[model samples]
Target: MSDDNKHDRDTPTWERETLQKLVLATVREQRASRRWGIFFRLLTLMMVFLVVWAYFDFDFPSLAEEKIGPHTALIEIDGEIDVEGTGAADNVIPSLNKAFSDEGAAAIVLRINSPGGSPVQAGIIVDEIKRLRAEYPEKPLYVVVDEICASGGYYIAAAADRIYVNKASIVGSVGVLMDGFGFTGLMNKLGVERRLLTAGEHKGFMDPFSPQSESQKQYAQQMLNEIHQQFIAVVREGRGARLKETPDMFSGLFWTGARAVKMGLADGFGTVDTVARDVVKAEDVVDYTQQEGLPERVLKRFGAAVGEGAVKAMTHAPIPSVR
Candidate 1:
């Protein structure tokens, strides 16, 4: 046998050895790459799942069980008084009940900052406040107006034992309004026709594109007057002899906090701190407001911006609001 052949038989050829090592290395690299790829893909899927879970979280806010010493309970009525918003009856009343029911809560201070909204919502809150007060007469409830408490805000505030306000705060708009835009002229200019059909007469009542009928106008005015009277009656019952009534008091006019105090619309100028420290005699103020969770806020805002806008645009009817 040749020396080279004899060496090849004893030990593998160098090329064959190199080739085998190269193939093994390639296989190991490929396996590692596939394992890393799978790991990354799984990581991405887990992150996506977490994001979706957070976004679609179904948990709504409930009153938390808090055990503490004597503190002034604070409930906030911030933003427009509506069914879904922060100042809604559902949100406010529950907090009120919890505050009034709390053994550690010395008193409740309802801090309000709103421009008013649905009269129905405001009325419901007012009724609840009245009921709660009557049920818990010893636990006093006061209102501390923030920026502006007008119309529906004031309606809720009126039920408080006392209302405090900052000197520059806006308060008191004792009136009802059903306001909307008339698009008839704009539609005419654009040469766009509005087609409205209904089974009942005045079914499309106060349609912005259509000319307002005289009878419908009178009916709307009468309804507004009746609601205004109801508002006036509430103010009278709440303020008692404190209110300095004027002819234009219920004429949809607003006033400053200082002016409100002078007109007997508010009790005096104070804040949540002052009311808690000085009036309630408890400096530690505990918030009892039922806050909207992330999901509720996201859904509500999305719906209002898209769906509510579309409905308002199509309907073009005046919404009876106290503003």
Candidate 2:
């Protein structure tokens, strides 16, 4: 045999060990990958569970579960009252329902501190309040104002049995408005031409980029006047004989609580504690406010912005703030 053939015949075959090592390494990698995947899935599930729990359970849920003793049930409206906000009708009404249904609840108090927001949202809350009050004639609903309760805030307060406030609290703004940008001047300065095309002449209505017509201006004003009249009627119906009406009561102006009392827009001066202790005749006060949780609020604002924009387009255009 040739030398080359002889060397080939003597060579050791190590391919089996090499192939075994390769197979073992591949199996270890797959096992590690599966373990890590399982770990991450468990972590994600735990996080989701915590967020859901927090969203449904109020900050201090123990307060809602206290012993059934005489107590005043409290629901707070602390920020701007918007349909998507914490003080929205959906948020407030559920709290009100829980308060009313509680066996030990002697009375219900709405702690309001807001500069006001959407009139539509306020109207929904007011209607619900009236309905709840009618259903629970034994439980009196009261509003205790903190710093301010204007426009829509006052609208909701009007449905309450009484309104109490501090001397410095801002009370009312009873009106509606439609504010928007008129960019005709900006466009003129910029030499920008707006090329808006629509099938209906008024389809491009209220477009800021286009020139505003006199008729459109008057139409907007008339719509505002109609909403203002509706607001006036609600206040009148709520305050009844208590409201000392004036020419400018619904002129979109705000007033201090003391002046509001003189005008009969508010009932008297008192704090939440005092209202509960004196008027409610219950010393123990329990908060039943359905506060928005961090995770849920974060999810809503971040996730629902796009969805809400679509909803708003289908619904009526954004009404000017009633602030």
Residue-pair clashes per prediction, in order, are 0, 0
lDDT of 1 by residue, 12-94 (tens): 57878898999999999999999999999999999998888777764555455454789999998889998776688878888
Q: Candidate 2: list runs displaced more than 4 Å.
A: 1-66, 302-304, 311-318
Q: Write the per-residue lDDT of candidate 2 for residues 99-182, one digit (tens) a residue.
A: 988879999999999988888888888888888888889989999999999988898898889999999999999888777777
Q: Which stretches of candidate 1 lie over 4 Å from their true place?
A: 1-65, 186-193, 298-316
lDDT at 74, model 2? 91
lDDT of 2 at 7: 77
Q: Rate the local accuracy (lDDT) of all candidates.
A: 0.88, 0.85
True lDDT of residue 58, candidate 2: 43
